[model samples]
Target: MSQHFVLIHGAWHGGWCWDGVIRELENAGHTAVAPTLPGNNPDDDLASVTFADYLDAIAAVLEQQQEPVILVGHSSAGFLLQAVAPRAAKKIAHLVFHNAFILPNGASQLDMFLPEVAQILIDAAMTVATPHGSIASPHKNVPILEDLIRNALMKDDSTEVQNALLSRLVPQPFVLFNTKVNTNDFLALNIPRTVLFCKDDRSLPPGTFLKMAQSLGTYELIECPGGHETLFIAPKIIADALTKITINPTFHAIG
Candidate 1:
């Protein structure tokens, strides 16, 4: 059966990152849309972006959809699913976390990252601050280093691919990571969900993704082979896995 997918990209990435996966999905006769959230847009004023803008952008996309979609969140977008799901519950048929973060209520994405890593992000945000601390300061965005991307996020891909991806990535809004998210209503939803993990991803400590996946109560577990940016490096693989998880009911399950 054909399905509709709404792909949400993670920090420093815009909707463009899902181009490959969307192509594969469409070729397989499914429909998909990847919306670049508010602060992620290259032309947007980073300092003006807020966490609410992210939620509002996502909600707007759901409002336009004619039918419920298989909502897929990647990396940092995992928590986005938790924050936006309850309010847009009726618009989502399923929730898929693709090597993403899952934060508990009152916790922020910064709380999930390793201390050193989180500190690096915090430092980056500080470095961009204006001497006068202007409201439009780029300090609101946390810059990502090329080494981190090549060594951790897309380690499985070729140097050419890594460089290409790095060129397009924007600085992620700092507020998105530091802001606490409320998941109380999300936890109450009875949505069918899937944790689509990439076996070779070493972006975080081993088993971190799986541990976060388990927080969903009961969920389908779909594993593939690739790094954190597998959806970009090996789009067809991710497209197939996402298709299978949404169309097939018997995938491995966890509680």
Candidate 2:
């Protein structure tokens, strides 16, 4: 009745972001592990990090588990999932995209967004040339990212909660969005895929979540309450949804 869950945090966040959900899962007698991606740490050099570094970090954590785990990817981590799933598909029991992006092969995360939105993120990346003429990976502006969190992710959250979570936000390695990902093995692998939606999520407009899930061709649709920050803001509800997915083999199919 117990399930192992490897929760993958999206960009700009570390494993610590999943503390709330982890507690809920633990309390429910299930296991959850949120791994820290390399270079995601404040002390780490983000400029030196690559997309592969992120994949390697997740893969390392996946390898440590003796049994297959319910692989849950949040936000941009859906793209991260597509890139790493193939390499360790056998160890993954299910694919859970929690208000996450689902990109196709040979496509970058930016490809999923509107041209203006993608360009905004692209233009937002600050580039610095090195002494050796090499260019550093683009870095996101901390204030800009913080504002987005306040406006979109935490729109429904209280000011206190917003500030608390905002303090935890870190600038992302922009290269993660720039990298083009592909995974043939993951596509060929047989795994139950589920897409969980938060009705109040404003990070992307309404209908965007289902749209991304639709791109997967076929998946189970599970909906809950709260916004994009629901994982932490409404942990119990989110955890309950996760439990429902874990126990129910048959879900309402979408796409």
Candidate 3:
């Protein structure tokens, strides 16, 4: 059976992040759509982007789908999807998290990270400056905190891939990380959910995701071998996991 998928990219990443996965999904006879989040890329003004803006982008994509689609979110996007999923639950068949955060009601992305991790981010943002002599949000260079992104996202990747990603990376709005989500209603919807944890992810550790799954109560946890940027590092593993979820609706627990 052919399934429709809506792939949501994480912070500092745009829709182009899913290019590799889209090709694999399409080859398997599935329909896929990757929408660029607001405030990502040179054409978009990062200063004006907000969490609601990202929700609108996902909602718009959901509106265009004729069938209930599988909505997949990576990295920071998990929170955004959690906020939008309830409203679009009727149109969404499943929720997939790829090395992403899955916060409960009234929780923010910062809540998922350790207190020290949050502090590091806050402190870093205080020192980040843009070319115009203005302070840019630290989230713009998420890869800087971890050695992996510095090694993988910008350097290890092919020249074409690195350029494409670099063009889309933007200073994420600070409010998005602090915004509280009212996910109580969303959790109650009981949509089938899955989490694919990349073992080598240096961004948000796998332990955080495991805690999220426990709090969520119902989810399939699948472990893959790669970094936080597995969409680029291990697209085949991700595609295979998606295929498993699509075909076996009842397989709710993995990893």
Candidate 4:
């Protein structure tokens, strides 16, 4: 059966981030769409972006598709998917969390991170002032924080990929990370869910993601060998997993 896949990227990344994975999925005869959330690119206004803005982008893409989509979200996008699932429940055939954060109802991305990690993010965001006159972390342009960011997020990725990613990354709105998401509606829908935990992910830490996946009640957990950015590091593995889920609604743990 043919399936449509919508890939949502995480913080600091744009639609281009999924180019590699999109091509792989297309080669396998599946349709994939990677949309850039507003304010994440150079032409976009970083100041005006909000969590709702990101959700709307995903929802709009889902609305145009006639067939159910296997919605995949990575990194910070995990929270976006949870919010989007309830609104586009019927259009979503399955929800795949790729080394992404999975927040419970009324919980924020900060809620998923360790207290120390969360504080680091908060402190970083406090340093910059946005167009809205709010102090937030200007993550995209900060060179001094590269080591910290790389250590926390892309430690498993090749140096080339990590460098390329850092150059193109943009500042994410702090509010997006802090906003609490109501995932109860999504949980109640009983959507087929799978969490792809990249074993080498340095961003969220493997142990933290494992614990979160376990708490999701009904979810298939798959582990891959790579860092937080598997799309670039291991597109073949990620693509294969997507194909498996499309072929069988049942979630199976994979390497």
Best by TM-score: 1
What range of 10 consecutive residues in model 4 has the weakest lDDT sum? 136-145
Candidate 3 residue lDDT tens string, 1-255: 888889998777778878888888888888798988887665776657677888888898898888889999988888788889877888888888887787878988877777887776566555665677746554433323433345533444555665555555655666667778887777777688888777776555436667776766668777777766668655777777787774355656644
| lDDT for residue 27 in candidate 3, whole number 0-100 | 88
Model 3: CA > 4 A from native: 124-148, 151-168, 246-251
TM-score (C-alpha) between model 2 and the true structure: 0.89
| TM-score of model 4 (CA atoms) | 0.87
Clashing pairs in 4: 125-137, 152-203
Shift in Å, residue 96, candidate 1 = 0.3
Give lDDT: candidate 2, residue 112.
Answer: 78
Residue 31 deviation, candidate 2, in Å? 0.9
Worst 10-residue lDDT window, candidate 2: 134-143
Counting clashing residue pairs in each candidate, in order, gives: 0, 0, 1, 2
> Which of 3 and 4 is the better model by lDDT?
4
Q: For model 4, how does the per-residue alpha-carbon lDDT over 1-255 read when each residue is reduced to its tens digit?
A: 668888998877888888888888889887899998877776777667777888898899999989888889988888788888889888888888888788777889888878997776777776765677756445422213577657777765667877877888877777778899988877677678888777877776548877766546777776667777778666887887777763356754432
What's the lDDT for residue 64 in model 2? 93
